[model samples]
Target: MCKPLSDAISQGRVSTEEGERKVWAALEAAISHFIEGGLVTDDLMKQLLPRKYEHWELRSRKPRPSLRVFGRFAMPDVFVGTHVERRDRLGAKWSPQWEHQKLVCEDHWNEAGLPAPFTDQPSFLYERYITSNARQKIRVQL
Candidate 1:
């Protein structure tokens, strides 16, 4: 998600500095409205995770007993998705892609007795974005 709101709009062939400045300005301007009354409270189920683009916030649901398990479980957390552009060429398959970097609630889909990358949320979706973005950029350059 290399913040689609940032590079895609401001860099329609403009300087990176100009693009960052404008995007930051817009973000600053919008913060107040977004936080007026919807601020996260202590009681809210909040998961703060780091992503490449914008920060991800997972709003978990009410907890419940697991039907398949003997213990309780929380609901799947939503990946508050975002993207960020690396200042340098990144080593990942995609350097400029909006890589989903954070694991919200759903990230823990791996059963305690199981391993990673094969949870309810497939890890490849995020990785594929990186790969496809790398290929797309290559195509654009070609």
Candidate 2:
């Protein structure tokens, strides 16, 4: 996590303490599941499309005004989060905000001198980086 993102989470920027807790819990759960080699369904984590974004999001959607942690994979099984946002607050005019978030992630990667994200097809990403049974466990609700 970047300083800004960590600060946002720690400072309860998700509007309420409960909201913050939910987001934090979801993030922790997802990370633990990933580390254990469990398949991360799209509902839990999604790679943005068009490939150019090279961005991924860890989503917490159970509560209203779901939270998103914007980041990119630094390598197989490694994600570096850069920003946080509320899904509802992103509004219908979301493309620009989404692009902005992508830019923020890119800047973070550059500042950290991280390697470029893997921007291959979804299948390729799964095959190369994720667990072998990832395809079978995939649930495409995105």
Candidate 3:
């Protein structure tokens, strides 16, 4: 997690305590799944389109008040979370929010001097960065 995201989580900006807890649980499950070499599906993690954003979101969609954590992959499996927001709050005007989060991530990458995020076909990225399980899932999408 980046400083801003960490602070947001710590400061209870996600929602009520219960909402925060749910989001935290979702985040932890996603992290553990990724670290354990499990196949992560789109429901838990999704890459933003247009490729220009180069952003991915970790989603927590249950228990109402869904949450989205925006970030970029620092390396193969290393995700640097930069911002988080509740889905309900974003409402229908979510594109601008996504753009803002993407900028936040890019700025963080520049400030930290991290290498550029991986940019390639979803198939290629899955093949190169993650385990083979993702190949089957991505094939259908591609």
Give lDDT tens digits, candidate 2, residues 45-120.
7777655566888777766557888888776667788878888766553478777777887887787777777655
Error of 2 at 108 (Å): 1.9
Where is model 3 more than 4 Å wrong at Cα?
12-16, 121-125, 135-142
- Deviation of model 2 at 115, angstroms: 2.3
Which has the greatest lDDT?
A: 2
What is the lDDT of every predicted structure here? 0.27, 0.69, 0.68
Model 1 residue 36 lDDT score: 44
Write candidate 3's Cα lDDT for 80-130 as tens digits.
777787787664635786667677777866777778876655454544545
Instruction: Locate the minimum summed-lDDT window of 10 residues in model 2.
Output: 129-138
lDDT over C-alpha atoms for residue 137 of model 2: 42
Q: Which clashing pairs does model 3 show?
A: none
Find the 10 residues in a row with the least total lDDT in model 3.
130-139
Name the lDDT value of residue 63 in candidate 1: 24
